[model samples]
Target: MKKIFVLDTNVLLHDPQAIFAFEDNEVIIPAVVLEEIDSKKRLADELGRNARQISRLLDGLRDLGHLHEGIELEGGGVLKVELNHRSFLRVQEMFGEMSNDNRILAVALNYHLEEIEKEAAKQVVLVSKDVLVRVKADVFGLKAQDYLSDRTVEPSDLYSGYINIHVHPSIIDEFYTYRFLSIKSVPGASKLYPNEFVILKDEMGTSKSALLKVSSDGARLEPLFLSNEAVWGITARNAQQRMALELLLNDDIPLVTLSGKAGTGKTLLALAAGLSKVEDEHKYKKLLIARPVVPMGKDIGYLPGEKEEKLRPWMQPIYDNLEFLFDTKKSGDIDKILMGLGSIQVEALTYIRGRSIPGQFIIIDEAQNLSKHEVKTIVSRVGEGSKIILMGDPQQIDHPYLDTVSNGLTYIVERFKNESLSGHMMLEKGERSKLAQLAADLL
Candidate 1:
């Protein structure tokens, strides 16, 4: 049935194109949502960018007809700017508030009553990214739903990039002797992706095993190229880290993604590989690192310093990993080493847009806080001979509209799994410390 979807301000901010997502359903943009968008249009952040995009989209739609009445969208639906002035009267007696949330709720309530009076067989559903808004809509006896059109995959079904198979003892021996195996030799291996890691074990519950990776053609399995190599004084401590290292150090794969919980060494491994490629191997001219600046708690407001000082708090984690890789003992020693090398660059993700990056080993840490559009922008900026690594913990997403499934890191993993130029690995073990791993698991 065709339903009327009342959009909250956050839904539009999260995705300006969300109005066209609901197929053949009428989209109602509350007047308060437009006001909120206007208020945020002046900010110099991703939110402001989205607000401006929404304004441009609405302006483009104005050529069709009056938005106050309705505009016929390209899809088989209508877009209307709902201008109800009911002032939250229906919800005031229950939960009194004149906030935008309540005002949006009033718009939905007024629409519901009009539909009921007209005896229309249609549903009025409030669509929002805010859980509290949905709950309050329920309290007012209205149907509500989360805007989920952007999620690429569910968290449970996220790709792990590797699989284990029980094979005959003879096959393991052949892989060990020849150091290569054909995909036809393994059962149910047709679905494997390029650069995917595989663990072949003896079927008799013995300890004989072989670790291999799918070749670029996806037709054969080869031994891991960097399994025994130490990157920037950090050796792979587990099987998953070894797989990640293989992908990270391989020059053929232009893009690599690593995901794990805190203390799993995702950032550490990426930094190690980047340092080796840029400084040790001279494969890339510079090592560039950046991350999204999503605040965990109440923001510390603005810092009173220059660019480097302003970015110190956000980029300190990256500096710590760099310090470990460079083995700097004293304070400011890492800064001295970086100055001497003249081949390292660190910046915030905000300033990376509109710049084409090339000939650098770029690492984007904490990528789970980026939206799909932001990820596309970053990946599209990579130039020839440049390697871009996206590492993040999907479970530790700080983006309000993004979750494990919808974040940019998981989106890249799912979208580029079949491409030969990209590879992914999920780091399962934490090597930082036992206490940190315990906190990650138990607490």
Candidate 2:
């Protein structure tokens, strides 16, 4: 049965191309949604960019037919800019204020009433990204749903980048002796991706095991190149961290992604490998670190001082790790040390747009806050001889429109799992401290 989907303003703002995602269902854009989108088109951030894109898309659709009445979409549904269904009588008593969300709800309510009056089979559904908006929709006795077309994978089904395979005990001994094992030798390992880590366990129920990574060719599993040696005075404290370091230090794998909880050392490990590659190995000319400026709690509005001063609070986590790595004694020593190094650059993710970064080791911290489009823009900016590492905890997203499965970090991890030049590892253990680990697991 053909359905009628009333889209909220945030749905379009979250994804400009969400109009075509309903697949032959009639998509209705309430007049209030357009007004909200127009209000955001003048900003300078990703939201503004998306607002503009959606506006232009709607304008282009106008040429085909009258949008106010209805236009046949390419997906076999009708697209309409609803202007006459702004009645708030249905929700005026329940929601007194004629706010934008209520206005959108009013439009959906009107359609639902019309459908009932005519005994129509078409289902009227309100699609939104806001939780409260959906709740309000339910209060009006309307069917509401979240816009979920952008999610690359379900949270439970997200790729972990590592798997354990139970094999004959001799197979582990063989891997130790030859330092190489073919994927065919392991049962139920036919679907492994390139560069995915594997733990070969004893099939006899023993604790013996061997850690190996799938070769880039996806043909065999090989031993890790890096031994127990420390990278910039930081060594892996757990098996997953070791896997992350292997991917981080390998120059052949140009793109690496790490996802873990707060104190799992995602940022610390990336910074350590970046420093080692830039300062010791000389493989890259500079180390560039960046993170989104999304705040955790109520924003402090703005800060006083220069550009570095404004970024200090957002980049403090990076600075903390850098200071520890450099063994700085005083508070201002990190700034002086950074000035002396001349090879490390820490900046906000905003400045990274439209710039081609080459011959540098780039690390994007807290990448879970970024949208899929934002991640694509950042990754596409990588130039020749550059390596980029995106690390974050998907479960801790701060973006209003992003969730655990829809953020860019999870998207990249799942999308690039099959690529030869990409490697991913989800760190499981937190090495920060026992207290931190306890809080992460229990609280």
Candidate 3:
């Protein structure tokens, strides 16, 4: 059945092209949505950029017909600017005044009533990114839903990419003597995938903990740090961490995606692995890092310097990691390391298009801001022998259309999980600081 999706401001703000998403279903944009977009159009950030894009879209649609009269969309759906959804009576009865949110809800309620009266036989679904809006829609007895444009896993079951195996005390001695224990020999140990991580704990209740990698074959369990004979002073805090480490170290699994909230150490971990692999292991030719210069509310156009100078702010995080890794003695020490390493290079994402990168460790930070199409473009640029690490938090995505479930990062995570050549981990803990962790949880 064709559903009448009531467009929310947030839905459009997150994605200006959201109108094209629901196939063969009519999209209703309340008058208030236009008003909201109009108000945001003057701002100067990502939201403003989207707002401007939406305005342009509406204008382009106007070329076809009056939006109020409904414009025929390309995908067999009509886009209508609804002017009749207002209900001052309903508004005063519930929240009072024509508040933007309440007005949107009233629009959905009015549409639902009309659908029932006319017997349109179409579902009236209110789609909003705001949790409160969905809850209010439920309270009002209307069909309300989360936009769900960016999520891969459910709120709880998002893949951690690793499992903990509780094994008999007998396996402990075997793990040390053989240096590589087969997963089958451990009771209850399931066959792990090529890039999977496993933590084996003693069943007899000793603090005996063993972290091992499930090698490409399900048979051999190789100790992770055996290649270096030294620890990096960083250990897995969660099962997800083990998964991340596995991908970071594995030469075969080339595309890796990490998503987490602030202080999750996504950038730190990716940089550490890149440095270790490129500088120490010589697995890759060089380390290359880049980020989208698309600022929160400003265009790449606002910058007034050479490309390198313009990219300095956006690339600061990568440089910070390089500085820390090289233990730079003073300011500008990071630039010295990049020059010394000779192989490691930093550039902007804009330069990435039309360039083939091979045999290098590439880290793209803030990848959540990327659209699905943009991500595909970047990934397709990877040549043989190259590994690309994409790290970003979907929840905090700055792109208007992208969200926790709908952005490119999450898209890659969900789509590539089954591939033996790709791996993903969603970091949950923040290693930055106590206050940062607390803020991430509370706010």
Candidate 4:
């Protein structure tokens, strides 16, 4: 049945076209939401971008009918700016003068009151990205929910980015003798993506072992038993990282996002995959690496040189990964090679806007630093034949307004999971060192 969805400002900021996302359902934009959008439009970030988008969208809609009176939306339902809900009599009694949250809550409360009096009216649902708002709605007896169309995984299950599974001891011998095993018919076997790791254990739980991916062909999956590879040299002592690597290196999975402690190898394996694709498979034209210039609570105000020089302190991690890939003694040597071959480019993510990139293996590290708007700008630039990977430790996120759950890494993971043009893994292992892994767990 069709219903009315009251949109909070945060949902629209998180996704500008959110109004249209709930197709055929009436999308109600509280007057306070527009006010919020207007206030955010001048901020120099994602919120501003979304504010502009909403402005443009509302302008486009104005051509059809009076926005004050509501317009029939395409397909079905309506889009209206709720004006009647501005009556602050009840809200002022409880929360006093019209604050933004109270005004917005008043709009929802008014809708609830209308539903109570009206017969045969559709149910009113409130959508927000704020927990407090949802709680307030519950207090007012209005049906409310978090706008979770963008949450990728549960916080408890995020797992630095890995998973592990166990199989029979005989299966292990089959892996040793046959060198690989297929789980198509195996009961309770995970539908592992390519490059995901599996900790095969005996059915009776006697023995445990690890298996990596070679390829994915439905039930006829192939295994890469190369435990000797440096990538797998660091064992996933915890089940979380074991799950994380299973997600990271899977070739069938073309995109990945990783977040953990500082040394969790989020940048390392992405560089590894980008290197493998560029050097070994010739699958992409170049490995384009980028990350937001958000300093870890420190600005580069007094840095020397141009914007490029200014970005150096922020991009040192990219250089570090490149140094590892080239096995070079100095960053200067790697720069020379990158210049000669033109197969690698490391630069600020800011230039990604208004450009379409094709046939490239792209990695956006530290993605949690990006605002929801910045992430959207980067994603819309994915041209044909390109794969974009985003990874970050959300727990250590640098964006002031973004937490582990609201950051772009998790947002992309949730958005792209079911798409055929995309596959994603979350790498969880700390290949840097034992101390690093210990710090990730302890600290």
Q: How far is 290's C-alpha from truth in model 1 (Å)?
A: 1.4
lDDT of each: 0.89, 0.91, 0.79, 0.70
* TM-score of each model, in listed order: 0.94, 0.97, 0.73, 0.72
Pick the lDDT winner.
2
Candidate 1 C-alpha lDDT tens digits along 317-435 = 99998888888889999999988989999888877889998899999999989888889989999999999999999999888888788888999999999999999999988899999
Give the CA lDDT, 0 to 100, for residue 409 in model 4. 72
**Candidate 4 residue-wise lDDT at 76:** 74
Predicted candidate 4 versus true structure: per-residue lDDT over 60-135, tens digit per residue: 9999999879899776778998875747788788767678877888887787788768777778899987888888
Q: Stretches of candidate 1 above 4 Å error?
A: 85-87, 116-120, 295-301
Clashes of 2: 0
lDDT of 3 by residue, 1-443 (tens): 78899989998887788898888889999998999999999885557777999999988899999988888899999899998765657756887666888888888888887788775567899999887889988887899887764456664655556667888877877898888887678776664655556778888899987777766555677787434322244555655665677677778778888888888878877887887888888889988888887643245656779877777888888888677666778998777767777987888787787899989999999998887767888999998899999989878866645566677887787777666777777788887889999999998
Clashes of each: 0, 0, 14, 17
Candidate 1 residue pairs in backbone clash? none
Could you tell me the lDDT of residue 382 within candidate 3?
92
Give the candidates in order of lDDT, highest first: 2, 1, 3, 4
Q: What would the TM-score be for candidate 4 when compared with the true structure?
A: 0.72
